[model samples]
Target: MSRRVKNPTGMRVLITGASGTIGLALGRRLVEQGAHVVGLDVAPRGDEGFEVIACDLTDDDSVTTGVPRALDLLGGLDGLVNNAGIGGPAPAEAAPGAEVRRQLEINLLGTWRVSAACVDALVASRGRVVMVSSRMAVMQLPLAAAYGASKRAMVAYADALRLELGTHVGVTCVYPSATRSPIHDSTAAAGLSLEGMSTYEPLEGVVDAVERSLLSVRARRDVPTTRKGAVEFFVARHLPRVTDRIVLRTLADRARSGAFDGAALAEGVVARHAEEVSR
Candidate 1:
C-alpha cells in the first residue's frame, strides 16, 4: 500500500550527497518547505542555503563523526536522506577491480553506515529515511555493470531495513530514471556508460520528489518514467532472459563499432560516485 507523507515543516533532515545535482536540489526543497536541512558532501563547501560539511562516508570516522556533527549542527535530526552513491561506466578491462570495490564501498557500505548511525534518532522522531536508488535497480542497463550492482545492493538494503524498522520508522527507496546532473557526466568521466540512457526530467523534479518522499511512509517509489525506462519496465519482468539478450547485443554492437561514449557516461557516473564519497 502507498503511504502519504505530509509536508516537512519544522523538521530536521540530514542529506548526504548534498553537493551533487539531486542532493543539492533536495536540500533546497527541504529548506523551502520550512524544514531545517544539514548538507553533507565530499567536496569542499561553497555555500548552499543549509550548512555544508565535508565527510567521507567510506571512512569509519567520517560516519561516526560526520553523522553526529550533522545532528549537532541541526540540533536534532528527524530524518535522513541517503542520496550518496557511485557508478563506474567503463569496459570491464578499463574499469579496475579496485575502482568497483570503491564504488561498492561508497554506494552500499557508505549508505549503510550513514543510515545506521541515524536510525535511532529517526526511530525516536518517527521520521523517515530516504534511500536514493536508481531505476537501473529495476531494469538492467548495458555497460553499467557496477552502477546497476550498487543500486541493486541499495535496494536490498532498503528492503531489509524497512522490514527491520517496520511500523515505526519509514524507509523509502526511490528509483528515478535518467536525470541530467553532473552525475550523468560523472559516469562518462569514470569510463562507464549507461546503454540506452536517456536525457529526461529536470533536476528540480528529482528534488521535489525527494521532498515529497520526506513525508512518505511507503517502502518504495518509482519516479516519473523515461521512454527507455518505461519500455524496460514494461517488458523486462515478463522477459528477463530476452531482455538480457537484447542488452548484451546492444553492448556488443557498440563495442564492435568502437562508437560507445564511455567518457561521457563516466562523467555522470563519477559525479554520482564523487558525491557519495563526500562526508
Candidate 2:
C-alpha cells in the first residue's frame, strides 16, 4: 500500500549543505510548496531566495551556536534534512586514516551533532528528520569504502534515532541511486569516478523523494529513489550472496580495465601501466 504524506505548507525546514545541488533543489521545491525553508552551509551562495545560515558542521561551537540561531530565525523547525556530505573514489589502501576520519566527522558525526542540537525543537514541533543516505549504504561498491561505511553508519543511526524518538518525531532515510550533480565533479576532483555505478537518474526524482519523505505521516524507514536502487536494496537484504557476487564481479572488471586507479590519478600519475595497455 502506498502511504500518503501530509503537505508541508507553512512548515519550516532547515537543510544542511543548502548550497549544494541536492540541498538547493530541495529548498526550492519546499518553498514552492509554501513551506518556509532555511539553508545552512559553510560557503553558501549568497541569497538563495531564503535565509542561508552560515554553519560549519565539523566545528563544535559553530553547530552549537548556529543551530539555535537558525531555530530563532525560523521560529521553530518542523523538519531537518541532513543533506551535507562528501564522497570520493579512493581504494581503502590508498586512503589515509586521517582522511577517513574527516569523512566520518562531516558525514556521520555532523549529522549527529545537528540532530542533537535540533532534537528539542523538533520534539516541540513534532517534526520529521530526513537523512540523505545513498545506495552505497545498502549495496557496497569498491574504492569508496569510507563513503559507503559512513553512509551505512548513518542508516543505522537513523534506525536507532527513530526507535529512540518513538512517536515524538518522524525519521526517514533516503537512498538515492547515482544522479547527475556536482557530487560527481567533486569526486572527480578527488581522483575518483562513479561513471560505471549506474545511469544518472533525474535529479528531480531525488528531490521529490525527499519531499515525500518529509511530508509522510507514517514515514517508512527506507526510501530508495530509483527502481534499480529498490531492487538492489531488496536483493541486498534478501539475497546477500547474489549481491556480493555482482559487486565483486563488477569490481573485478573495473580492476582489469585499469580505470579504477583514481587515487594514482589524483596524485598526478598520468600514465599507469593499465592505462598504457588499454590505450
Candidate 3:
C-alpha cells in the first residue's frame, strides 16, 4: 500500500523543473500550503517564495550533487515531483536527430536520474513520488514523435518505479493536457505548432492532480488532469487501433489545412497524410 501525508504543513517536498510554468506554480502552491518545498532547475531563481536549487537534470553530476543538497535542506523528504521535462518537434519517419535525443535525455532519463537519487530518502519517509507526464504519453500526435515517445517511456519508468517501491514508497503518474508554456515555443518555431490539434487546459488542473496524488490516502496509479484527458487516455490505452485511426484522420485534416506547410521536419508526414487523404 502507498502512503500519504495527511497534512501539508511542514511536509518536505522536492520538485524538478521548478523554474518552468508548471513547476513554478506547483512549488508556489505547495509552499502556500505550508510545505517545505525545494525546487531544482537549470537556472534557479530565488524569488518564488521557496528555496530553489540549481540542478541541470541532463547532467549526472548536477543531479547527483543537487538532489542530496535538497534532501539535506529539508532534513528528509516526504514527496518528490518529477516535473522537469523538455519538448521539440521530431517526425517518426525521419532518423532520430539531436532534438529527439534531447527530448529523451531530459524528459525520460532526467526524471529517472532524479527519482533514483531520492529513492533512499523517499523510502525512509514512506513518501510518495509524482511524475508529471504528458497527455501525449498515451495519445500520440503527428510530427512530434520524440515528445510522445519520451513521455511514454517516462510512464513506463513510473510503472516500474511503482512496482519496485510499492511496499515502501508510493508512486503516481499525472498526465496533463497541453497548456500554454514556453516548452512549445521550439515546436511552434519549427512551424509544427499544436495549436489546432491540442486543446489547452488550465495549468491549475495539473497542479491539483499532482497535489492530490501526493496527499491522497492512496496514491493514484495514473491520473489525467481533466475529464477529456481521461477519455483520451482510456481510448489510447485500451483501443489503440481506434486511437491510431483518430490520429490519422486528424493528421489528414491538418495536412489539408496547410498546418505543416513550412515545417521541414514534417515534410514526410505531410506527404503521407496527403496521399492517404486522396485515397
Candidate 4:
C-alpha cells in the first residue's frame, strides 16, 4: 500500500537536467520550500544547494544505476521531473539527420528511461511525475520540426503514462514557452533563431507551473506556464489549421525580412515561402 505525502515540506523529488537554467532554479526553490530534492545531470555541480548525481539520462546504463542511487540518497521518491532536453534546427523537408535523432534521444527517450526507472518508487509512494514539455509540443514552428516532433511525442508518452499509472501514480505535463536558455544556442548559431516567432516568458512562471503540477491535490492534464502559453496550447490543440496558417504567415514574413537568408538549414522553407509570395 502506498502513502501520500500530505505536507509539501518533506516531499522527496528527483529532477533530471538539474544543472540547466530551469532545473537549477527549480531545485533551489524546492529546497527553500522545505522539500527534499535530488538532481540528476550529466555534469553534476554540487554547488546548487541540493544533492546532484551525475547521470546521463540518454544512456541506459547510466539511468539504470543513477536512479537507484538517487532513490537511496533520498530514501524514497515522491515526484520525478523529466526536464532534460536538447534543441536544434531540423527542417521537415530535409531528411532526418543527426540533430533530429539527438533531439528524439534526449527529449523523448531520455524521459522514458528516467520515468521507467522511477516507476516502482513512485507507485510505492503514490507519487506524481511531471514532464517538462515545451510549447513547441502543441504549437509547431517552421524549421524546427525535430524539436516539435520530439516534444509532441513526449506529450504522447505522458498521456499513455497517465492512463497506465493513473490508478496509483499521477502524471502531468508542463508546457513552458521560450525562455532565455542555452538550449536555443544551436538554433541561433544555425541562423534559425526562434526570436521573432516566439515570445520569451519569465523562468519563474515555468517553475511555478512545475511546482503546481507536483504539489497539486489533483494533477492537471496539461499545464501551460503563462497565460499566453495557455492560449497557444488551447489554440494549437483545438484548432490545428488555424495554427498552421499562423505559422505559414509568420514564416512568410520572416522570409521577406531575410531572416532565413543565410540559414542553410532553412533554405527549403525560405524557398517555399518565396514561391508562395510569388504566387
Candidate 5:
C-alpha cells in the first residue's frame, strides 16, 4: 500500500485559479478536511467557501503581491495548486503560433511567477506544488495545438522545478484528458465544439489526484496517477491520420449542432462518464 501522510488539519493551502472547476473542487475538498484555503483568481468564484482574492497571475507584480496576501490570510501555506488555464481549438490548417504564445503567458509564465514567489514559503513549510496540465501535452489531439503546446512545455518546467526544489518541495504535474471544465468556452472561442466528442474524464479524477499529492510525503504525483500511461498508450497507438479524421468529423458535427452551453453538457456527460469509469 502507498504511504498516506497523516492528515495535516488546519494547515493552509494556496490555490491559484480557484474560480475554475477543478480549482473550486480542490478548495472545497481541502476546506472540508479542515485546511485553511486561500484562493487567487482574475474573476469571482461562485463557490463562496474559500478565501478568494483578485490577483492577476500574468503580471509579476500581481504574483509578488499575491504571495503575502495569501500567506497573511491563511496565516501560512502548506501547499500550492497551480490550476489556472484556458483552452481553444486550433483552426484546422492554420498554425497556432500566437495562441500558443498567449497560452504560455498564463500557463507557463504565470506559473513561473507564482511558484517563484511561493518557493521560500513552500520550502519553509515543506509543502508541495500541484500543477494542472492536460492530456494534449502528449500530442495527436485535434484543435488543441495551443493548449497542448503550453502543457507540453509545462511538463518540462515542472520536472526541472521538482529536481531543483528536491527533497523539500514536492512538485506534481497533473494531466487530464478532455475534461468537462471551463475549457468548453475555450473550444467554442476557437470556433470548435464538442459535438460528437464522446470521451471525457470527470473533474473528480484531477481533484482526487491533487488531493493525494497534498497528503504525499514525496514531492510528486501524476494527477490521475495510475491512468496516465494507459490513456497515453491509446493516443500513441492511433495514427495521426485517424485522429485528424476524427477531429474533422467532430468539428463538422459541432458546427451543425449550434452553440453549446458548457454547464448543462458537463453535468450530463460527467455523470455518465463517472458511472462508466466506476464500473
Candidate 6:
C-alpha cells in the first residue's frame, strides 16, 4: 500500500504569492482546515488567518532571509505552496529580452530560490512542496513563449526535486489550466485572447488539488487541476503534431481577423512552418 500523509490540521504551511487568486484560495482553505498558514509575496496583504511576509522572490536576499523568517513565524513548515507567478503573451523571438527574463526570474528561478530556502526545514518536518505550474507547461501554444517556457521549466525542476528529496519530502506539481483570473487581463494586454484557448476552470478546484497533494501519502508528481487539463496533457504528449496544427490554425484565423498585433505572429507561423519543413 502507498504511504500517505494526513491532512494538514495543526500543521504549519507557507504559501507564496498569497495575494494572487490561487494562493488566496489555498490559504483560506488551509486556514479553514486548521493549518497555520504563512503568506509570502512582494505585496503582502491582510489575510485574516495568515501571517503575511513581504518578500520578493526574485530578490536573492529577500528569499534567503524571508523563508527562514516565515519558518520562525509559523513555528515550522509542514507544507510549502509555491503559487507565485506572472503571465503574458509575446512571440518568442519578438518578445523583449527583459520581458522574458522578468517572467523567468519570478516563475522559474524565484521558485527554485524559495524552495531551496525551505528545503532543509521541509526535510526536518517531512513536509510537502506544492508547485503551481500551468497546463501551458505540458503543451506549447501560440504567442505565449515566455509564460510557457517558465512553466515548463518549473515542471522539470519539480521532477528533479521530487527524486532528490525522496521519502524525506513530498513534492507535487500542479498544472492548472487557464482559470478565470487577472491572468486573462495580462494575456489580453499582451495582445492575445482566450477565445481559442481552453475554458477557464474555477479557482476552488486548483486549491483542492493543492490540498490533496499535501495530504495524500502517495501523491502524484504531476497533477492537472481538471479533467480537461488531464486530457489535454495526454494529447499534447501523444499527439503533439495534432495539437500544433490545431494551435496554428487558431492563431492563423486570429491573425487573419487582426485580433491583435499579428505581424509577429505571422512571422512566427511562417518560421514554425519552415522548421517543420526542414525537419
**Residue 249 CA displacement from its true place in model 2, Å:** 1.4
- Cα lDDT tens digits, model 6, 1-279, are 134658668989899998888888888888888889998989976754677889999999999899999999988888888999998766776846776898999999999999999988999988889899998897887777889999999999998998999779988888888878876786676457766656778888888787888778776788888887888888887999988888777766665555655444446665555566568
The TM-score between candidate 1 and the true structure equals: 0.82
The worst-scoring run of ten residues by lDDT in candidate 4 lies at 1-10
TM-score per candidate, chains pooled: 0.82, 0.90, 0.96, 0.96, 0.78, 0.90
Tens-digit lDDT track for model 5 on 130-246?
888866665445545667777878888888988998778888887676667776776665445554553577777768777877777665545543465345635544665665576
Alpha-carbon RMSD, each predicted model: 7.8, 3.5, 2.0, 2.9, 8.4, 3.6
> Where does model 6 exceed 4 Å of error?
1-5, 261-279
* lDDT (tens digit, per residue) of candidate 3 on 1-279: 245547899999999999899999999998999999999999877787889999989999999999999999999999999999998889888899889999999999999999999999999999999999999999999889999999999999999999999999989999998999999999999999998888999988888888888888788899998999999999989999999998877777888899889889888878777787679
**Candidate that beats the other on TM-score, 2 or 3, i.e. the better one:** 3
lDDT of 2 by residue, 1-279 (tens): 146778778899999999898999999888888999998898889868788888999999999998999999889989999999987664565646766787788899999999999999999999999999998898887667788899999999999999988679989999998877766675666656777655578889899888888888776789998777788899998898998988766655655565546556333323433474477
Global local distance difference test of model 1: 0.73
TM-score comparison, 3 vs 5, better candidate: 3
lDDT of 4 by residue, 131-171 (tens): 99999999988888999999999999999999999999989
Judged by lDDT relative to the true structure, which candidate is superior, 3 or 5? 3
Q: Candidate 6: lDDT of 62?
A: 91
Q: How far does residue 236 in candidate 3 sit from its true spot (Å)?
A: 1.1
Clashing pairs in 5: 170-219, 171-219
